[model samples]
Target: MNNYNHILAKSVENGATTLESHLESVADFAVVAARYAGMDTEVALQGALLHDIGKASVVFQKRLRSKPSPLELPFRHEIASLFFLKLVSPDLQPFMIDMIVAHHKSIYKDVSGTGIIDLENEYEEDILQFHLSDFSLWASEAIGILAELKFPGVTHETVITEEDAREAYYFALDHCRKRQKGWSQWKGLLMGADHIASAVGDFKEKVPALFADPDVSFYNRKGELYPLSLIDSDGTKKHTFVKAPTGAGKTDFLIKRCRGRIFYTLPFQASINAMYERILHDLGDHVEDIRLLHSISQLLIGEERITEKVIQDKFGASIKVLTPHQLASIAFGIRGYESVLFDLQGCDIILDEIHTYSDIMQAIVLKMIEVLNHVGCRIHVGTATIPSALEKEILEILGKEQVQYVQLSDEVLTLFNRHEIYKAEAFTDLLPVLQQAVEQEKKILIVCNRVANAQVIFEQIEELYPKTKKMLIHSRFKRGDRNRLEKELKNEYNVSPYACIVVATQVVEVSLDISFDLMITETAPIDALIQRFGRINRKRTAETIGKYKPIYIIAPPQKDPDCLPYNPKILRDSFKVLPDGGELLRETELQSLINQVYPKVEMLNIDLDAVFVDGKWRLKELWHLPKSALIEKLDIDSVVCITQEDDESGKYREADKEERILMEIPVRYSSLRWKRLKQLDIGAHPFVVPDIAYSSERGLDLAKTGAENYDTNYQIW
Candidate 1:
């Protein structure tokens, strides 16, 4: 009629994004992205306009409203979208199909098993019949919007029958199924556009902000302690590498070296969150100009939560803070890897404090550096104590001549002398030290190698000092609880004048700005020890200059299994290098110490497993690489589980996706050793763990979380 208002592509909580609006928004974004990628703008725009027309169908509308969909099971709107392929010009039809066919997923072997080719092979019946069910009516609706959009080859007079739609579907399918040797930039363009349109509703207002050039003048301010801020960032070299101690303004210096939009990555989520907040403050409250990306970014507390729910736009921010996991896809060539490459092309990517990563992570980083350089990305690496071997590997990847390297003089490094080192045989040996620190009303931090160890230490301290304020945190807590712990650690404990203690795992060993008076940590990798040591005596200012704090390292366990997540040899080497007898830690000697521990760099040869190898992408035809591409190659085979109360009380179902994520707890995949356990069919498909397995104070009870003792029937609705 007057308008095809019922046609929708994006379904929000209370309202729907109409097909016409979404198409227009996506086209606007696609055209701009094309300009950056140096591709044809018109072609990109046309592809975006036609990418979501299939959502105009009645079946998709019915599904959006939660009514029974008319089309057959495992319905794919992308396949249905291909029916209108005739609207595109024949010369450009192949590119247009590339934009639509696999924009949502692959044309073949999609994880959902609903890819066009997958459906064609799996169905006994003519699957086209179900897709074309009442296509005559929806085709009219689709045409109405296309005409309204003033799309080419379509007007009020244009008409397409169900048979015409069927012919177009087969043509598009045939074109996509044919193998090619290289990837399609057209698919990348459309995917980026559609993702932007669906995520940020105010597409018009936000389109101009993509790949923004932000103000780095604030970080360029001169200071006595912040020496990097005074160094000239302008140079012929495009890449940068800086080795500096904590509080030496490494973050500010890295930002100052950027030539374009920035993607800042840390090795951990907690550090990313802390950096996100710090950058926001440093940028003078330009909240719309930045973004935070990670699995748990939405779980950020208070103001971060409010801002996060409103701004779902992952790309186009002047700056983005994330972990390496989010960008690893490009190296592996996983699904949507093209979009990530498109976003990162010609941008400045900063890998902050990356010396702490393991060999597997370092290998990924090395490959990522090569790929990023190939795509014109300027890589800036900042770390305190990088081994010589690792540095050589990165320098080789980035081209030694192309990088502007900066490191502090031994004299300047001496200014950062802040910690007095002590060693203990075990955590039990630190009890007297902990008592003295508490008696002096000193803020104490205790870090362990494992979550169980942290929990055990937390209980021991709780029993020893009942009146002392204390908290424990690790990777295993429900997201909501973890958020509270981080908030308190940052705001309450860090700022509190009273003596308190916090026991944690490796989670806090990154760019978190929390400072404590004393630290007792289990022996770890040399680089990790440096980062943990930085957490003590961290309030580096002119007045606090030369002020020294104590850090006690507990000797590492001797057994193989007990030293898990770290090599026994590396741990032993690390503990041996630690200073005992109250020796001052010289920031000048860190590199030498690091190379001593990591004498041989063990690089993972991921060439056989990676999609991007040698000099090109291995896959062709835009098909998916399988979910296992990530899960198998990395330690991300972890799973989340929900509390029985949350699932049974209907809270889990009632909550939105972000809210439901807060109720779930993450655990190692190997932790679920039982065959049969009750599961929730939503949001990671988490298992229903018993109430006894979790608490708000202590995180997931590892010993009690085994599924062997639990019966499935107890959790059934």
Candidate 2:
């Protein structure tokens, strides 16, 4: 007990500002996780408490040194924990240690092989390798803390030595490698033990009551009840066909069926925020029940603060709405994803906009559904249009021919008036058009295809109506600023007679709750256009507010040869990869567009890499080549800066646009490639030169090894 208290005291003393808080929260979260996974609570709680003891290791200390250390800081907490456990209990089962190690496994393989360029030579031979003894110190410290705390079953054996440390480190690494292949029996055993340990945390105890509120109703766009009875019915699970257009109360219908904890997977961040706002407005009392689970959400929303006590509460009946990436982390089993397991048990999920996901993404989502359903989750998915592949994947995964699907009734259609689309040849002179609307005191949303374009338009509008009220919104701007803008927009600051124009990018598309009287949008994908149309006249108010205004599509000038409306190459390539060949286009006017566009577009007949077979897209090395080649063929090289701070001169001068990096990448497909460059740092850019002109000090000269020296002007492909 004295030893345990010592460790606890030390942790509190040495812990960084958020370290203790993080530890407590994770411990509490672990308790709920354990119970949800059907484990005993006591062991889980203890494990969670000790998970970060590895922080006492020498490696961790080095991280806090005055000078920048060559050694990477923040060793894997799981590794540290596992090492610490072994030190105190030399005979501890290997499976128990495996759990700690495999907790936050990396799922994505770097196919580009250029993961953040390592100009600093981080992996160089001179760097010292991490030793096991360094890890044991953290483990030992943890044991002492537990002992001081007088926690039952907290006892220490013989002191740890260098040999024991080395063996444990090797064992852990091998175990982690094995886990990457697939969970082993040993892994199951560790998980079982960890589960038991976690159950001791408070989160395992009681389910929240918010989910059971009687006020919730599961209805479709038309206010009709969902067929809740279908869950137990013997008939085939008919795929729910949602014909309702966007903003027709589809989300409200989903909220009703999700009486327990809910997991809503949206297609985009905008949609997630929109849903969060809508949910907050309709069920303001349940705002606390809502857990916005997305990268953006984690950074921007929520002021309540995530504490150990809050995490201790079981996720039995709450709300967790996330983007596909956040949810993907769960399916792929990342560290944070384990919380999803705790949240999912006996939960209801709303998979909105089911058809928007790509085929590979759809495959993963279906697997997620299968796993969640197996763990006792009921899901309701809604989409403007349901594709056959998506429908088939969901059915196959759920092992049902049909799922409860309610269609929009003709009566509901009568309530939603038809929207008219006007095509404009040029928007260069849009200020006059908007000036008139501003004179009439109408709220208008001007949407552009790119941030740069949005900034240009906004600047023009501001000049045209310098004294008029206006604002610009996009993802690049700081999150707090956007939230503030949203608040002002909501209270009628942006739409009042005094408020004139709000310029925005695609971020305005989904999850934004605001409505505009008029919208001027650049040409984009059909689905995006439909989404834009939804922003206008949404509530069907009696004043005919939206009817008086016309929504304009600012079309680009017709090509010299009068090309097709859509990109023929993109359409044709999509068709070849599509499962039904071109048969899937039967429901829409896509075929004619495909025919018209293919003539002018390049590489229409190119085959996409086959990613799926036998109801799944098997992961392989070659599946990404076609996409890479396409970008290469298009001569799209992403702009990259070797320096930490970007130079703000010349073409790289800071743009007025929000979130605009100083480096102006002229290429259209740079963002895609930027994600692939690995090991990037603020080091000198390496130049590849022939062996004859090689210099050791300047930078890497790839030309010596028959690799081209990177040049900004050279084609990346």
Top candidate by TM-score: 1
- Model 1: per-residue Cα lDDT over 1-717, one tens digit each: 358766777676545788898898889888888887789888887888888888887778878878564454766788788888777778988888889888878777878777788888898247777777788888888888888888876888788887778888888777877858556778877888887777768535633357567776677787888777767885798899998999888988899898778899998878998898888788845534677886577765355345444443455668888888788877776788877887888899999877788777788888888889988899999997888888898888888899889988888889999999999888888888889989999999999998888888888888999999999988888888988899999999998788899999988999999999999999899998999888888987888888889999888887978998899999999889877888999888888889889887887787876766777877776776765343354665268888878877899988887888899888766777463557778778888787777888888887776565454647332
TM-score each candidate. Answer: 0.91, 0.63
lDDT of 1 at 30: 89
Provide the lDDT at 452 for model 2. 60
Clashes of each: 0, 51
Error of 2 at 46 (Å): 4.9
Worst 10-residue lDDT window, candidate 1: 304-313
lDDT of 1 at 407: 88
lDDT score for residue 545 of model 2: 26
lDDT value, residue 560 of candidate 1: 79
lDDT per prediction?
A: 0.81, 0.47
Candidate 2 global Cα RMSD: 11.3
